[model samples]
Target chain A: MAETTDLDVAYVARLARLQVSDDERRTFQAQLGDVLRYAAKLAEVNVQDVEAAAHAVPMFNVFREDRPRDWFTADEALQNAPRSANDLFIVTKVVE
Target chain B: MTAAELPALTISELQPLLRGGAVSPGEVVDALQSRISEIEPQIDAYIALDFEAAKHEANAADLSLPLGGIPIAVKDIISVAGQRCTCASRSLSNYIAPYDATLIRKLKAAGAIPLGRTNMDEFAMGSSTENSSVKITLNPWDKSRVPGGSSGGSAAAVAAGAAFGALGTDTGGSIRQPAAFCGIVGLKPSYGRVSRFGVVAFASSLDQAGPLTKTTRDAALLMNAIAGVDPQDSTSLPEPVPDYTQLLGREIRGIRIGLPKEYTTDGIDPQVKAAVDAAVTQLQALGAEISELSLPHTEYAVAVYYVLATAEASANLARFDGVRYGHRTEGVANLVEHYERTRAEGFGAEVKRRIILGTYVLSSGYYDAFYLRAQKVRELIRRDFVEAFKKVDLLISPTSPVPAFKIGERTADPLQMYLADIFTIAANLAGICAISLPCGFATSESGTQLPVGLQLLASSLDEARLLQVAHAFEQSTDWHQRRPPL
Candidate 1:
């Protein structure tokens, strides 16, 4: 078994942009550690020369005609937004 | 027609009656509504029921269309115009979809009335419906036990005869496991077989929407309506859609079936094993050549799935920041806090854990160690199936190791819960199509009879052959005829 190190729980949570409570962080650290340790069993497999497979069936660059088409009206598009202003989604201020 | 009789009719049985003018669509919807009224309280099978809209749609339904006014329950993850597509998460609890998903558009175009949105694991996350923020969907067979999830409600609804058939999204056995636990037929079409234009993404690469129905024929009818290339979804297959229903009565005399030795390990429930073994005997009697094969890398499937699926989920879910749509945090000072608080409040524990784990794996130093290694092992796993298929026409296994446990049985241990999908996740990883149907009944400790699922997997886009063999087995057996007592 690869000697596992304690996951930097806080740093990882922040990177995911999730505000996990301190209690949740502690609980998750142990739980996530268990999952990762179990997942470490993958190292036992000799995949030395195998190519990585991403999507199941190999199809790529699935493009369509580059032409304008009908789409959601501005009202329809912004209907689900928590807050909207003049058909634009409103969000917390990000700039000065 | 009485509510008692409505829950017992399959889509094929109802279609002729509907076409012959023996029943109006309103009466059909009313019969189903009555059944839903009788059972929904006990099963908790739906997130939102649109009786008025369903009746209105039914009244105006074109009986000349393929679906012929059949009412189908949709998983809350799939959008239906003007209906709430909650995905069973509080974040989108109040979010009503403005337009229909591609599947919904096809179903509606085929004259299928969308009756209601069913419950599921929050954002299609967990194996059991317990993850839903909406309500717990109980197994129609035994209320104390759970309906398998993240498509639990759809399975339970169909099992309870609340809907003739339903739609479900399978990421990692979400549709099949629940269908097994609920004693229904669930098909997870090959990755690109069904379009995912508006279905909420859990793991983009693994997610495919399919059907949960009482019989294989019903699943096939649904496939005919919904399985087609959609220009809106880039990953949708370009292959011409076939009439899947035409192959139902076809012969399966010389089909080669592979029984992976890895799937028959000791951890499987004895009853489930016996049932699948019995199913193999039945298939053999029908002239299918059954042979034991090895998917040697099977042991790594769950581990690889978690690594890759979570990585994809972490990235896919990033779109749910508190900005555009979904739930947003209030009183946030800055962008960072807004994103943090919104996600913290919006997502469930399992979703958060997966996101964090996904982030950890895809993080800078550990990418090669965890994510890359898993991807490489995934290739080996896929190659194992490729080699096995060279010798066999299809692979069969028990859908879940055990039947449905109590709702809280595996909640404390995420790893234990993840193992619930040990048998079903590989098909999703390999991007192949698979189906689960009731094999037999196993009595629980309390003498409650639970259903076991037998799974059949086929190579990518081979649903025609997959459905044909499954339909033969289903017609030869009485398992699909059994209904849950709600």
Candidate 2:
């Protein structure tokens, strides 16, 4: 096993837009440390000239002709919003 | 038809009966309702059921169409218009799908009825269905044990005869492992074979929606209706679709199978190895040549899978901000606080763990060491399969290291739970097709006999050959014919 360093749980959580409690921060830090340690095994492989595969199949520039088609109506798009007013999503005031 | 006969009928068996007017769709639905009412309470396989709606659809169904009137369970992760597609999470518990998924539209066009929404791991993250916030789904074979997951509900429902067949999305063995645990047939089609248009994203690169059925032929039957390209999904393949059921009962005289050496690594239970070995012998007897092969990078599959899957999941799941359709936190001071609180409160522990792990790997200074390295390793894993296929047409292994464990056995250790998916995850990572079906049984320490699965894998876009050989093996054995005592 590799000597894995502890991850900054609070910092990562902030980037992920998740508010972590103190206890959760401790738990995640230890757990993430263990997983990263296991994941360090990837470094043992010689990937000298191997290309990183982002997609399973080789796909490039998959585009269809730019044509307008029927899409979800505004009512359908906003159907699931928890709070909506006047056909717009209601959210906390920005630009204070 | 007698009530006992209804649950045992496969899709092929019911096709003629419905077409010839020997049985009405209403009768089929009634029989299924009786079976569900009896077994559903004990198994907890369904998150939601629309029996009245299904009956209405059944009554109006055109009996002339393929798959006409067959009731199929839809995993909650897939969209069913006007239905609650919760993905077994509290985050979207109240959200209803605005429109049908591409697969759903196809199934409806083929005259199949959407039976109900099935439970799954929250965000399809965990191996066991215990991660579901809705309820723990029990194995119909033994209520004390789990039906393997994250497709546990669909597998359990099929095993319990609650639905004729079901659909499940496989990412890291979510479908196959559960199907194995429940002693049913499950297929994870090649990544692009099935559209992911409205299937809730877990690990986008790994997820493919496939069928879970009582038999291999039934899996082929469902695949015929649901497998195709969709304009809505850019990742969908433009490959020509074939009638998967057309070649059922085909001969497999010259098929070559490879048994990888790495799958026999530590932690494989003796009973599971014995069952899969016996299955290989049985296939050999049916005239398919078998050989030993090696995939040296197999040991690193689990490690590489976690890095890439979590990274994709973290990005995909970021859409669930409180301002949108999912659960939202109240009394937040600002937009940032609202986003933070909503995510913290909405997601479960396992989901949050992956999110943080993903966020960390994709973070600055760690991207090269973690994410990029894992992707390169992933390429090697795919290359291993590509090379192995040169020697043999397909590979065989144990779907899981062991049968279903006690419900709460591995919940305390996420690593232990992740290991349950070891054998099935590689196929997904390679974007290849694979299937799991009953091979034999494993007796537990308590004398409970649980089902074991034998997995078969083929190279990408070789589903036709894969199904042909699987159907041949299935027809020769009685394993798929057995049902749970439930």
Candidate 3:
């Protein structure tokens, strides 16, 4: 089993942008270990040389013409925002 | 229409009556309203009910389309022109979509009325709708137990007869597992069979929208209306979309069905197993050739599913930053604080955990060790199905290991909860077509009877064959008509 540490859990939470409670942190460290341990079992498979099937369908640049087409008005779009100001969604100001 | 005392009506059954001028769209919507009013408090299947709009649409209905004014619920993850697409999270709680999902456009074009948005696991993350920030979507048959999720509400709505059919996205069995737990018909077409233009991304590689209905033929009909390629969704498949309903009575005689031995492993409930076995017997009696097969790599499916799904989710959800739209938090004085507060407030526990795990695996030091390795395993898993299909015409399995459990049963145990999808995740991983339908009943201590489902999977673009087999089995069974007590 690959050894997982609290640092790993903390780093992950940071990346996920979540605030993990300290009490939950310890629990996650252990839980994350178990998950990684189980996932580590995949190392046993011999898939060398097999091409990965990343997306289900083949990819191509399928962009359509950038012609202007009237869609929902900006006012209609902002109608469902819980809080709005000046015809745009109003959210808490960034600290910076 | 509590699940009980109501025999579920499929779109096919309602469409003819509705189109032949025997029934009005208003009648169907009104009947559904009464059903929703009777059951919403107990089942909590819908989050937003658009009765006024539905009535307006029904009154002005055009019956020339294939759907013929059938009422349908849109899973919260899917967007509708002027309706909220919450994806069941506080951040997107009031996010009324600016445009209709491609499928919703098709439904509207086909004359289907939008009943409402149904509840789901927040951001389509969890197995059961327990992670819904709003409320638990109880299985219609047993109010205390959960309807499987993140498409749980879609299943519950269909099961409770609130709608003839509904839309759901399958990202690691969201559609099928819930349909199994709720005892309804749910289809997850081959990964790109249907466009994903407006279905909130859970795991981009695996998310594909399909139908949750009461009958296989209805799933086929719904899929027919939504399966064409969309230039809007680059990932949508270009395969020819055949008329699946027309293929319903197609012969499956001498067709080989593979029963993967791994699916019949130790932990499956005896009742679920018996129900699947009985279905297999019924299929055999109807002319399908059945054989036991081995998918030795099956043990690795769940592990790989979590790893890859999370990795993709982390990448896909990165777009929900505080700046452009969605929720934001105040006070911490920086971009980072805004990002942190917004996401923490926006997402639920299971969703947070998955994002964290996904981000971790794709992070600097772990990418090669975790993400890349899991990708290789995923290739092997896909190959396993490819090789298996070479030996059989299709495959069958118990949709879920057990019937739906109580709402809070596994909420605290994330790993235990993830295990609920062990059976259905393989299809998403392999990007294949699959469906789940009621097989029979299972008695539980939750003061109600529950239903289990038999799952059918077919190779990509082979949905017609899958529907033929499912329709054949459904025709031979009476389970689909059994309703829960009010």
DockQ of 2: 0.72
- For every model shown, what is its TM-score relative to the native structure? 0.98, 0.98, 0.94
Clashing pairs in 2: none
For candidate 1, give the lDDT. Answer: 0.91
Predicted complexes: DockQ each: 0.78, 0.72, 0.48
Better structure of 2 and 3 per DockQ: 2
For model 3, the superposed segments whose C-alpha errors exceed 4 Å read A58-68, A71-96, B1-8, B445-447
By DockQ, the best candidate is 1
Candidate 2 or 1, higher DockQ: 1
The Cα error of candidate 1 at residue A8, in Å, is 1.8
Q: Which 10 residues in a row give candidate 2 chain B its minimum summed lDDT?
A: B245-254
Interface RMSD of each: 1.4, 1.7, 2.8
Per-residue CA lDDT of candidate 3, range B165-242, in tens?
999989888899999888889999998888888788878889999999988888988988889888788888777888
lDDT for model 3 comes to 0.83
